[model samples]
Target: MPPPPQKEPPRSFTARWAALKNIPPFLVMVWRAAPHLTIATMVLRAIGAFVPVAILWIAKLILDEVVRLAALPDTPDGLAGWWHSGLADHLITLVALELGIGIASDIIGRLLRLVDSLLQERLVIDLSMRLMDHAAALDLEDFEDAGFQDKLERARRQAAGRMSLMGTIFEQLQDSLTIATLGAGLIVYNPWLILILLVGLIPAFLAEAHFNARSYNLDFRRTAERRETDYLRQTAASAETAKEIKIFDLHRFLSGRYLDLSRKFYAEARRIAQARAAWGALFSALGSLAYYAAYAWIVVQTLTGDLSIGDLTFLAGSFMRVKGIIERLLSSFGSTAAQALYLEDLFDFFREVPEIASRPDAIPVPRPIRQGFVFENVGFRYPNTEKWAVRGLSFTLHAGETLALVGENGAGKTTLVKLLARLYDPDEGRILLDGRDLRDYDLDDLRAAIGVIFQDFVRYAMTAADNIAVGRIEAREDRGRIEAAAHSALADQVIARLPAGYDQMVGKRFVQGVDLSGGEWQKLAIARAYMRDAQVLILDEPTAALDARSEFEVFQRFRELMAGRTAVLISHRFSSVRMADRILVLHLGRIEAQGTHVELLDQPGRYRELFELQAAGYR
Candidate 1:
């Protein structure tokens, strides 16, 4: 049965205000991303903030001069007469000064936007790099956990989506400065006007804050559904899933599921939007009434001869500017808070520390391992699972010998190999290397010394040479080593068929990429194992896609390559299993028997029964 949709809980007003705590850290990140740009933006905004008042004040001076000249007893009859009388000189100078300030204001605005664009791009790049580095440092187990994935998705989205928050913050700072200057001018005429402005706009500000909280809550609750919809959309059209989707005729099903989820999202968003628009209209009307009230008071004072005409003009203009600036400041404050909520997700992800990091003063892995690994009463279970994948397992892999593990599906063979590589620490007991616990060695050095190619390896969309070099990425530039490894794994033949050989792009993900057959991809995967010159090598069903003849040839080459190094091979084919110096038959996560092929086949046990079953298939 499908799970019920999650409910969107209302975020508290206090919670919204608390999100403000994230702003300091967020600004710190912005500063670190581009310090020079940040400083430039602030300096420009500070200069531009006072331009409006300067323009308004100049207009007042020009108006007062016009009135003085018009009331002259012997006023000039025309423009030529006025210029000759020197009457229009003060008015003309005021107009020219205002024009200059206006132009400078525009230049400053343009510069601010240019700096902001560059700064935003820098911030995104820095955030993405940090996210990648932190994710790389995390444990493999963390990626496998479902909760961690959701946090990761949210963090990834915030890294790019929060660029607008930076601009909003800068605008708020500029608007606040404008408000202070305008409010001071209005206060000189009548301090009551400031009171009227706040009374009218506070309701609208509260309404904006309330609705913004709802919007954030709605988005937060639907993160999982959003991820599901994205997956469905990708699956319905992507190249990797196209063949299977067509074979299963799943396009309609996928589209229908996506539509259903999308409709639900639309319905919820529409509800909040409708409410916001209604309240916004009502509160906007109140704000307009407040501005007019202040205007009426200014006119009354002018008519009573308590103030001059120029005073009325200045006071009215100041009141209107203050009202508009205050409205925007309140609205932007709410928006900034909402964006800060998302910043919490990004910072929270950065706070996540890896649980499996190497201890301080850890020793490096021993070279030319004199003694191989020993697993003593080891047991493990996957996270959030009750059943153990492997338990009570004990074994020794001696140095300079090839060990083959033969088992059916769910026999814990792959789990055992992961433990050997220390991709995961055992939940119980210990795995020792050269008489010391595996945890005592440096994690990176230990992994560097062991080469492992799992069954479900990644098929990177890269050049053919890069595919093999991934096994030992430090040797990526060594073309000779890459070619030798490919030859050893019989992948050279596959690469030679491509138009560009080793330099040819593989995988269908990119344009001009050449796709390979399943067997050919497996051969490339096997080559990665040979690329690493490690003390221990493990191949987990590396040739499962190859034909019997090809598998036989690959295993022959594999045996030759294991000369003085410890190796572990896993294969279902009895032909390859019989070649190992010793084989361990596993059942239900336990070692059922261990011996040479002839010895195991002679015994009347599970190994003989499984071998006979495969033999019967040939009949």
Candidate 2:
């Protein structure tokens, strides 16, 4: 049965306030990430903030002087007359000052835009790097969790989208200062006008906050669906799945699913958008009414001789400027609150501490392994599931012994390998190396000491050399080692045939990439194990894709290659299993039998029966 879809728990008022608190720390992170650019942006914005108020106040003075000069007697059109009147000098000075302010404002705005773009780019890169580093530190089990995938998806979006939040915040800061300056001028004329403007803006702020929260909630709830849609889109169109999609005629099926899921999201978003627009228009009209009311009051005061024409012009302009700024600031604050909620995803991901991390005093794995692994009553169940993948399993793989594990599909062969690799820890018991718990050793060192290549190995979208180099990434530059490993895995012949030899791109994702046949790709993956050259080696059906003769050739020299190393071979083919010093038959997560080929064949049990059944196929 398919698993039930995960649902998001509803957020509370306190939770939203908590999300809001993340904004300060987030901004601090951005500032630290790009200190020079951040500071420059703020400095430029500060200078630009007060320019509007200064220009409006200057214009009022200029107008008052014009009125004063117009009332004076006409003067002769000569330098002496103009100088004697002082009007030309005063007017020229005011006009030059206003023009200078306008030019400075234009220059400051362009500089701010340039700085913001650079800072956003730098911050996104820094954030992506940190995200990757932290993700790499998490356990394999964490990556397998569905909830964690949802969180990761959200965090990835934040890595790109946080720049919008940063821009909004900077804009709000500059707008606040402009509003304060304008508000002060309005207050000197009449305090009640500022109050009226704020009152009208309050409803719009509340509406914006309400809609933003609703939008975020919808996005949060639909994360799983969104991720599924992305998966379907990739599956339908990506190069990896393209051949199967075409052969199965899955394009229409996938397209229908995508449309259905997208339509649901679109409907929810459209409803919220319509409501926001309707309410936004109503509140905006209210604010407009307040502005005109204030304008009318100022005109009446001017006519009543209680205020001068300059005072009327200045007060009206200040009221309009202050109202617009407050509206914008309040609206921005709402959007900023919603953005803070998204920041929670990014920060929460970073906050997740890996449960499988090594201890501060973790011991280094013993080199040239003296004693091999021991599984003592080991048990494990996958997360969120009741069925134990492996339980009460006890076995010893002695040093220099080649053990083969034969089992039916889903009989826990891969699970055992994972336990040995410490990709997961057994729930009920312990895995020991050299009589010490596997957990006691430094994880990196422990993994480095074992070379494992599973049947379902990844074919990296890189050069063939780089693909093999992944097994011992530090030795990537050692061309001699790469060639040697390739030869050992019989992949050297494959590479030799390639147009670019070792440097040939092996996946279909990039330009000039040459796709390899399945068996040929398996050859390259097997080469990775050879590159590792660890003390313990595991080949988990690694030859499943090889041709019959190639498989036989690989096994013919397997013992010679693994002469001094302890190896575990998991395969269904009795030909490979019979080559082991001991064959272990697994059934229902437990060891069913252990013996050499002849001994197991004589027992007349499942192993013998399976061997005869397989042998009959070729007859």
Candidate 3:
């Protein structure tokens, strides 16, 4: 069953306004993305802000000039006569000036839009890059945490979704300036007109703010559900899941589940939207009443000879423009606040600091090591879990030794390897490398020294050579090195079968890409370890997909190549286990037995029982 939707605390008006603090930092990010484009947008918008007032003033001059000419004695009777009399000169010039202003406004509007588009694109690119870099810096544990995953999902959406907020903010700036100029004219005529404008618009503005906060709260509460729906949608249609979905005939089940969640989301949104619409209509009617009331007063003053025809047109135009700008400014202010609330997600994700980072004065991992790793009474539990993954663990992996770990599922085999790589730090006790705490070594250097390929290694949808080069990406252009690594892992055999050889894209994710068999993919993954060629090498069930003969050959090559290197191998196959100089049997997150394979078998323990059971299958 789907879990109950999470509840979000009701957001107050003050809380929405408080989100405005995010705008400054957001603008800073925008500026940093493209400084010249940002500056151009601002300058153009500033100039455009005055165009409306200039056009309106020129329109008033044209009307007044016509009125004066019409009232003059001995006026010209035709257009040509008027030109000959020079009577239409000032009127014609006013019309041309207004036309020029209108054209310039249109050009400025287009330029602003072009600049805003470029700036927004740059911001999205910059934000996505920042998210990638920050996520890389985070600990593996952070990705595994559910709360962190939600934050990451929200931040990922915000990286692109918040681009609109940039344009909206600039529009608000331009509109605010327009309002100030338009409002000044209205105030000069009658301060009460400005008062009436505010009074009418306030109700609509308040209603918009209230509804926007509701929308944000609804969205915030539905984040996890939205993520689940997205996952379900992908699962039902993705190439990766297509085979299983078809085999199980899961289309109906998946589609039904998605529809159920979507309907619930739609229903909630519709409720708020309905309420907003109803209230908006009522409030908008009230504003219209206020505008007509002010218009009636202006008309009365004109009829009483208190204002000219030109004054009437100018007042009405200025009043209308001011009212519209103020309305939009208020409505936009609310929207900007709501968007700012979403910005919290992106910035919050950025604010997350990795707990497992190395110290500032961290030293490099020792080269040509005299000693190896020592896990002394190390204990660790995953975040938000009470159960320890590995507890009271003590082991020494000596330099140049090939140690094999034998265990069933959930026996902490993978967790132990992760600890060695410092993907996680021990909760209690410490790990030692060469007589010093493992935490003392520079984290990046420590990871570079150890190469690990796990059972669930990534199948990158990239060229075969690029796949191998990812292990040591700096050497990607070195074709000879990539081929040598592929040869060591027997991946060259798989590559030889591809149409494009090393250039072949070997995943089904992309167009014209070829898919490889499980064993073939394993060979490619093993090649990454060889490409790394680190001092410490680990193969954690990487050959599980290969046949016995192929696994044997791969291990044989691995043993040859791992000479003079510290190696850890985890496998279920007794044939491979017997080759290790020392073997550790793990059960329930602790060492159950430790000896050579023959030595363990002679002891008649769990190791022997498991080996004998496996051998029985052969008979």
Query: Could you tell me how far off, in angstroms, the CA of residue 434 lies in candidate 3 after the best superposition?
Result: 1.0
All predictions: root-mean-square deviation over Cα?
Answer: 2.7, 2.4, 2.3
Clashes by residue pair, model 1? none
In angstroms, the error of model 1 at 394 is 1.6
Count of backbone collisions within predicted model 1: 0
lDDT of 1: 0.89
Ranking of all candidate structures by their lDDT, best first: 3, 1, 2
Model 3 C-alpha lDDT per residue in residues 558-607, reported as the tens digit of each score: 88877999999998888887878899998888899999988999997889
Q: Write model 2 residue lDDT over 31-125, tens digit each, in one string.
A: 88899999999999999899989999998988888777767788557778877777678877998999999999999999999999999998898
Q: Which regions of candidate 3 fall more than 4 Å away from where they truly are?
A: 1-10
C-alpha TM-score for every candidate:
0.95, 0.95, 0.97
lDDT of 3 at 226: 96
Candidate with maximal TM-score? 3
lDDT of each: 0.89, 0.89, 0.90
- Candidate 2: lDDT of 521? 92
